[model samples]
Target: MRRHRRAKIVATVGPASNTPEMLKRLFLAGVDTFRLNFSHGTHEDHAKVHAAIRALEAEMGRPIGILQDLQGPKIRVGTIRDGKITVAAGESIRFVLSGADGDKTAIPLPHPEIFAAVMPGHNLLIDDGRVRVAVTGLGDDYIDAKVVIGGTISNRKGVNLPDTVLELSPLTAKDRVDLAFGLELGVDWVAMSFVQKPADLLEARGLIGDRAGLMSKIEKPAALDRIDDIIRLSDSVMVARGDLGVEIPHEEVPGRQKELVRACRLAVKPVIVATQMLDSMVNAPTPTRAEASDVATAIYDGADAVMLSAESASGAFPVEAVEMMDRIIRSTEQHKLYRSIIDASDPGEEQTAPHAVAAAAADLAEVIHASTIVAYTSSGTTAARIARRRPAVPILAITPHAAVSRRLSLLWGAHSVLSADIHTYEEMVERALGFAKEEGFAKPNDQMVVVAGIPFAKAGTTNNLRVVQVEG
Candidate 1:
């Protein structure tokens, strides 16, 4: 099932959509990629879901990408005596480093890194900002804080220190285990959370090697400070606006999201605008007008993909949410304004031979009114570059490597198909035309613009462009 829309949909798999029937429905509903959230499910649970996805892919003969989202260094308060407590504003509280039960006066915060890194005057947000506290004093084993906006504080509630960049690795022990499991499962992308600098990516790369594409989740304010370096090192970026909104001012999130999206585009790294995109759809049969507009806005901004978290994972209407997202993207792309906006934000100046050739193919497709732009790629980079052009025609990316075919699934306007590697120019054209016809992207006598590298099976050598007339 080919989607005419450029922007793709990423659906999370959870209890609500764990069954094979629901998984197939989501794939048919227009989910280009499946996100396996490591924070929630167990390894066994995720393995089952991964197996289901692969089964569906084999049944349908369509490449599907799997993104493993690592749960990085999530800080939270430890156990409380009564399980919860209600603190009034203007009250004082103590966060003890010792892992012990707490009363109204104090709570255990087992994460020593936070206590060691936090200083007086730094803000600590609890329970997703439901309760706010300002550090009044720091001790060797505890932090004295004054409640600024207090509410019910419960056991294991998340703690966010927006004012301080704790000296910590992005990966937790659980994340390392999860990463190894995901890599073993052969996931296409691994999204690292709370990445503060480019060095974080290097650490992940050292572990991941080339097993999967490393996608940096840009949430921390420190990450935004060194956005360029992070984008350069990472294979992709996800604008995780949930923690981001909590860390930065809510009003600044939209601008920051745009900046990150544009930066990733300039770097030619795929960017996913994620978190709360259709949060209302988690329960409601339909999304709010604002929710729909938020998705459309991301597509208009030339984002490669928009993601659904709870909306698809544990929502009452998973298929409906995916359909709504698909509708929103299609509607936005059909707007005359979208094309102009995408053109205006074009990443000018081709930096490599492959980039120049991809641009030429896009132009050729437009001039000839070709049915599709066929890209023969080994590592999927050539297809990605062509998709970045936001060409009016669909991009049919043929690859020999299953991983490459699956990874290209997330790229905008890319329709990936697995085929044997082509050796000669004639073989390339023959396979391209045959697959385009078989895939219903074109008919006999239709024209296509094909792009690829010269040396067969060579990666990152996409320097050839040709316009071919499909044989009758």
Candidate 2:
């Protein structure tokens, strides 16, 4: 189905939206991509969901994207005495590298990376920053800290070290296993979590190869420090605000999100604004007004996609949440000021052959008020460049590779359809007109801007641009 909006919606599958029936409903409601979060659910369960999504894709005759999200190196507090402990502000807490339960004086941390990495004056945020502590002393086995924000500390509460960079791989044993299974399942994208550096993506890229798009989750301050490099190494980026908010000051999250989205746009990569976009919908049938505005703000910032985490995975209103988000995006895009905002934040032109062609195509289409911009891409690179321009008209990207078509579903303004490889300029023009008409992007006498690589199918070459007109 054609979406009314440009930005894509990625919904995670879980208890609430696990059934094939529910999955179909979500697709109809506006989900362009399905995210299989490895943090929860068994491999078997995810396999079933993957199968269901493929079945739905076949029945619907639309290329759907699947993102395999790997849970990376999550550090949480170990079990506490009596299942919980209360430490007052300014209280001294000594964290030991043990697996046993403990009281306030000697809480078990059980993570050597933290002990090895954290230094004096580093801040440790626990339970999503509900309780905070500043490192005062560190020994080989213990981390002594003064409580800065005190609250009840429970067993396995997640810990966030905002001021320290832990020396650890983004992938763990569980993630490797999940990545293998997901690659075998033919997922379109693999999202790595807890990415702290550009080098962190090298391992994932080596493992993933060209099988799927590698996306780095931007939730760590260290990631922000090297975001351009991370974005350069990865195919896409995700603003994982839930964890990001805890790691950085809450006020900085929005600014960071805007900068990340704009940076990705400038780099011509898809960026997803994720986590709690419609958080209130998990319990309520509708979202809070602020949540709706949040989704719109991401769209205004030019994000390629926005994701639904718990809202769709375990919420009471999964379909409703998708519908609401879809409506929000459409409404925001149609807002009179939306185009102006997108134009104002435009990163300008990249001085290269492919980018020049894409920009010329966008410029020509707008000048003539064309019905659509048809990009004949084999590697999907040309289409992505066009999408980065935020063209006023819809982008009908025709690709010979179904995988490329599916992956393009995440790009803003791209409506990809798999077709046989075009052999000549005559064939290219004919197919562009045919597909544009068939997809309802144009009618007889309508104008279209077409672009492609000259040698074709060789990839990364976007040299040709043409203005084609529909004929009766």
Candidate 3:
């Protein structure tokens, strides 16, 4: 089934939508891709979900991408003696580097990295900022802090240090194991969380190799300083605004999100704006007006996809949330403002043959009023370049690689399909024409702008563009 809107939706699979029947409903509801959150479920649970998704893909005859979001280094306070505690503002507390339970006077901050990285005056936000503490003194194994803002500090609550840049790998030990399992499961993408630098991508890439696409989760302030390098190194990026909003000022998130989306567009990398797009839909059947506007704003900013976390994973109304998001996107795209913004954002001069060819195909499609811009790609790069142009017509990406086809599903305006490798130019055109017609993207006598490389099956070699008419 084709969506009327260009932007895609990524729905997370969880207890609320893990059943095969529910998964199918979500797919039909307009979910372009499924996110397997490694942070929550067990390996067996995720494997089951993965198997169900593939089964659905086979039954529907469509390419659906699965993203394994690795749980990076998440630091949290250790257990408390009474399961929770309330510290009064202006009270002093000690964070000892131990794993044992503690009383009101102190608590265990078991992560050595955080203890090592933190310094005097650094603020520690606990339990999602409900409790705050400013470090007054630091030692090799403990921190003496004064409570700036106090509330209930529960057992093993999450800890966020906005000022400290811990010297840690983006992938935790659990993440490495999860990555191995996901790769074995044949997931299309691996989203590395809390990526602080470009080098964080290298280690994951080394492990991933060519097995899966690597996506950086941009959530840290340090990541913003190296956004370009991170985007260049990774296959794609996810603007993870959850931790980002916590680490940085909440007001700065919108501007940072716009910058990241625009940068990814310029670089032709698929970018997903994630975290709480339809958060309220997690409980309520309908989304708030502010939430609808938020999703629309992302589409207007040219994001490739907007993601739903708890809304689709563990929400009370998973299908409704997807349908609501779909409606918002379609309605937003119909507005003249959306089109004008997309048209105005130019990706500068073309640098490669594929870039020029993709640009020419988009231009030709608009000029000739073609039914579609069909791209023959092996690595999905050509299709991405065409998508970056924000063409008026839909993009039909025909690929021989199943992974490439699935990955392209996350791209804006890209409708991906897998086929056998074509060896000749005539075969390429014929395949494009056949799929365009069979998929109901075009009819006989309809014009199509096709782009591909001269040497078939070789990746990143898109250097040709042709205007072809479907033969009657």
Query: Which of the numbered candidates is closest to the native, going by highest lDDT?
Result: 2
Candidate closer to the true structure by lDDT (higher is better), 1 or 3:
3
The sequence of per-residue lDDT tens digits that candidate 3 reaches over residues 1-472 is 6778899999999999999999999999999999999999899999999999999999999999999999998888999988988998999999988857787666998989987789899999998788989999988888999999989999889998888888899988899999999999999999999899888889999999999999999998889998999999989999999999988889999999999999999999999999999999999999899999999999999999999999999999999999999999999999978878888876575687778888888988999999999988899998999998999899999988999989998999999988998888789888888899888899989999988887888888988888899887
Candidate 3's C-alpha runs over 4 A off are none
Model 2: residues with Cα > 4 Å off, grouped in runs: none
The Cα error of candidate 1 at residue 34, in Å, is: 1.0
TM-score of each: 0.96, 0.99, 0.97
Candidate 3: C-alpha lDDT: 0.92
Distance from true location, Cα of 95 in model 1, Å = 1.8
Better of 1 and 2 by lDDT: 2
Model 3 worst lDDT run, 10 consecutive residues:
345-354
* Model 3 residue pairs with clashes: none
- lDDT against the true structure, per candidate, is 0.91, 0.93, 0.92
Cα displacement (angstroms), candidate 2, residue 80, comes to: 1.7
Best-matching candidate per TM-score: 2
Model 2: lDDT of residue 241: 94
Q: Residue 331 error for model 2, in Å?
A: 0.8
Looking at model 2, residue 32 earns an lDDT score of: 96
